[model samples]
Target chain A: MLRLCSENIHSFFASESPDEHEPPMPRSLTSANMTGRAPGHTTGKERILTSAMLLFARTPYSDTSLRDIATAAGVDVAYVHRAFGSKAEIFRQALLTLGPLDDIAAGEPDGATMISRICDLAFLRNPNRVEDVRPLHLLIQSSLCGEARAIIAQFIDSSLALPLSRAFGHADAGKAHFALSLLSGFVTHRAVLGPADLLAIPEAVQQRMLQTALMNAMLDRSDPGIQGQIN
Target chain B: MLRLCSENIHSFFASESPDEHEPPMPRSLTSANMTGRAPGHTTGKERILTSAMLLFARTPYSDTSLRDIATAAGVDVAYVHRAFGSKAEIFRQALLTLGPLDDIAAGEPDGATMISRICDLAFLRNPNRVEDVRPLHLLIQSSLCGEARAIIAQFIDSSLALPLSRAFGHADAGKAHFALSLLSGFVTHRAVLGPADLLAIPEAVQQRMLQTALMNAMLDRSDPGIQGQIN
Candidate 1:
């Protein structure tokens, strides 16, 4: 029975059909660096990562299993274990395939430019035309978990908070933390909440709303109302 | 086999020990109004609703079964089916118990007052001591699903957007939407992401951060750069 299930999974991946069973391979996985080899040789690993990314994006880590990823990728459960070592490793590798976070870690960021870059990395469709790049979505959900949560917190502190603190010469990095909060809030809304309703509002108006929120959050303007009573 | 499983489920809920097996009865369920009578008279339905809420909060709809709720509530599967009619109805009723959305639909809202109310309804620890209210968490997860997503979206529109439009005297209710965005973001971060790490920051600093974000999002102050460009 297990062998039968494994074969079914393998066939599903090899066919690469845009079926209900498989999330079609994302464009990012097709890139040279992400796949790490020619498509002919790394097809199995590539397919597994693509499926892993899709599942992780929408589902919480605790609920997702190696078998589920393997089944989605059309491979055996053993194949998944052999390839990725563990579920955590699969998730971490999947996250790395999403666009770079280096810019957030170092250098000065312009308000408009930073907003555009963050939005693009988050909302831009992969080459396969899939929207809501799954790894970023998964990262938000992963924040609730253990090791993954620690990794994400560290990433935010090192990549975002520290850079913003240095960029504007503020002794405090609260602005960067707020900036992350704004970006995270926007993306979470965009992904989990169906964007169809938001689309009813004029696109320009909504974009301006986000831009304003991001700028305000990134700049350290204190409100007197919350000062002394905050603690 | 199924009967044996059902019996085991019944024992689990009936014992009602503070084991991981059961989500302790929420105060809302214990209330005279919500459960339809005194606790002794309506233990079965109340337990079912409590179990349903916890399951629905974390598990996806399709993934959650009547059997699971029955098991968690210490009732027979038939009892759950007979009492609730369908899984969807049980979910809807569970949502109703969270508290009224009438305030969001129509009223003059003070931002701080409204924020406090929302935080209470969403984050309040039930008598059972579960800090994360399952329904709110489930609502966030439900956004990725179908009918549940529609219900949540309508709730936001009726409860939040319309009222905020009236409160602020803006023909556009986008501010209310933004306010919901901020609140949702905060709650999700608080619930799914552990608060222990955040506690490392000074209490005043974190509270000030949320207050500032809420204020900026609720007030429709367009940035100068994005002003003319906004539709």
Candidate 2:
């Protein structure tokens, strides 16, 4: 099952920038060198975070060592120790770099488009990395572990739930959390079930199911305006 | 990651019979010895198939040894070899014992009840094993492998799609498959997200969403009777 761990997290995440062909490997542990704006230039700390992300995504916590991350990042092992302090801390930072749920949370109230965007984020493959989405996959695969699960749950609460609720015209996190749960299930099912034939279903039907279910999960029925549209 | 393998395939499958306290260790595994069944007795081949199912469900194919299964089943390892020929064959046979699609395929047409039943199978846990359902969990965990994915896809086609189509009063497998895809997505979401608060969204609304979506996914506009009722 360790083989299920992806080696492509670095590629998947780095593919956002065209020139990041190689991982960020600092030549020296100087903050001045790290502060440069070149495409692949990363501070020693950023290098450790990205390296830790890639390594941790591919190997479970106990199997990964600080030395492995340092070597991958082309830095000294002691540099990694000084920057991240511990493997757990490195993992937390790695997930932190996935950016906030601001894309979902900060957007205006457009339930249909918002649902589609959420689905896209959860299920779409990055154009550059055909079959990899490291951070999402890492979170899903490691969700069975207590520590990773807690970290992810916390992230969802602060970044996803609160913002999603505000978008739906309610301050309650319950609706946002439920809507997210449904979306997560759908994504996970598609990945694990790999029911390719299901793709043959008309795109319209799929969209309808997704939009309707999401609206139902996220909004209250007290509003006749939304209720009428839903029916 | 290997630790994710279920240690309970034995318990999950064996819990079907109360008296199966000791694994079936055939004193003689010859064809003649394989024939008779006294109340609770099993043929050597049956024992091997069940044992393989339990073991394979717990551990990945490459990691599990015949010796481990034989020890668990209380049989000689060579007996497993003689009986099933190869690990691959044993795994296929184990899946086969999850039984034919007859239950789903042969049922009376009741879309509401059928949808409810399908949901139950996908989401419900065994009353005895509070947190696990070994075969489903095994399939999800091992789906990254080609063999398990193929077997599961085949099972879904036969068990889920075919019968569900029949229940919808048509022979179209498309509707059933689409509905199933949605249900599978929902189930996978709950398992991975662990969003317990989603349960707070009143049972009536949940049931309505399930039933309505399933009906929409499974029925065509050509059926005025069903369409009228759905509205």
Candidate 3:
């Protein structure tokens, strides 16, 4: 239901500048400079975040540690703290590294094209960066039981819900939420479900289903009489 | 994508029978009490699982601990281990308690009403059961990164892809997988994205989109246009 500009969406997918080839790393923490401090380099924080993102994506959060991130980034533990107050802060930054929100904001007005473009971009981006996404999942799981749940929920709410609502022209909040929910569900299912299971559904049929859902949400704004009925 | 029986779908929305009114505990586990464990005498393991499920649903998985589950279930640490062996197993059993799969499986054929009934059933079930669903989400997240991911993937395969393929009489593995993916995406979206998002698009429009896609898939069988196009 979010209204994205086609150009923006296209940019997200196509505008892969060479700099974006690899995630931003903390250059200051490179092996050559093993010392905790990075003189006059803002990238010190970026490096910590990049390392955290990689680890979170590949490993479960519970299994990952601050030490592991520090070692991987070639930075001292204290430096990590100085750059980002906590693992959570590092994670928050790492997630935003993809810059979906900024992308959406920059590309607007061409809502229909934008939505499709964004989807294509996401599909291409392999949103599931094991080091980053995996830990985020762990954090999400932890939020359900731990004190951090609120923070995680807030992140999801803002990152997903806020931008989505704005894109959809501030239409019915409930409906926008539902649309977002459906999109998230699809992405999650794709990531979690196996190739075998995925292979079960015919490619043609899958494509049709996805196309139909997206088109309907984007193009057909009128009531079609089958809304609640079709499920 | 999956073919659910009408009766089962109906039952999912209907309240429990008056005679069956008891705690939310699964009957299978409760009835397992033997000479040592009485009908009312819940095992420490069961308690741990129950507590874990509640916590998992309400909290995120990473935040939860054996200690939290034990404390809530009124059991000790050892008991938690004696019963499920690990946090993963406990989480798995807790999900089985929700009975979504069982409910879907139990539905009888009623082609005209099946889809609507299934959707209704899903919508009727509260997605806010944080305690119940949180662990499941954790399991799903963890599975993406570990061995258990395969198991979870298989479960999804059997529950959604297999049944739908059988119903459609499609031998083509790829086709079936695609269909399952779409359905899974839809369901996930509904659950995670709030109703608000769904309600954004006119109800009629949503219905038409779904109907078009479903009808096209059924009729064409081969070419459901727009393989990668956004619906």
Candidate 1 C-alpha error for residue A28, in Å: 11
Q: Which stretches of candidate 2 lie over 4 Å from their true place?
A: A1-41, A53-65, A108-110, A127-135, A145-147, A171-175, A201-209, A219-231, B1-38, B53-64, B127-137, B145-147, B170-178, B199-231
Candidate 2 structure quality by residue, lDDT tens digits, B1-231? 323322322333334442432221211222322355663577667767656655565555545667877887789989989988876677666655543433333348365556655654544333232123234545544544444556777777776778777776777775566567666555445554445555566645654454444454454322242223222
TM-score of chain A of each: 0.63, 0.68, 0.61
Alpha-carbon DockQ of candidate 2? 0.19
Model 2 score (lDDT): 0.54
lDDT of 3 by residue, B1-231 (tens): 001111211122123242332222223434432225666776666666667755654443444677888888887788788777887677666665543344344444332133332233332322233222322343332333333445556555655445544444554444444433444444444333223445466644554444443323322322223334334
The DockQ of each candidate is 0.20, 0.19, 0.18
Docking class for candidate 2: incorrect
- lDDT of each prediction vs. the true structure? 0.55, 0.54, 0.45
Chain B TM-score (each prediction, in order): 0.64, 0.65, 0.57
How do all models score by TM-score?
A: 0.65, 0.69, 0.54
Supply the TM-score for candidate 1.
0.65
lDDT string, candidate 3, A1-231, tens digits: 101111111122233343344422222222332334454453656567767766654443444568899998889999988878887676566655533344444556344444553343223332234321322343322321222333444555666556655665764444434444444444455544445545355544443445444444434342343333344
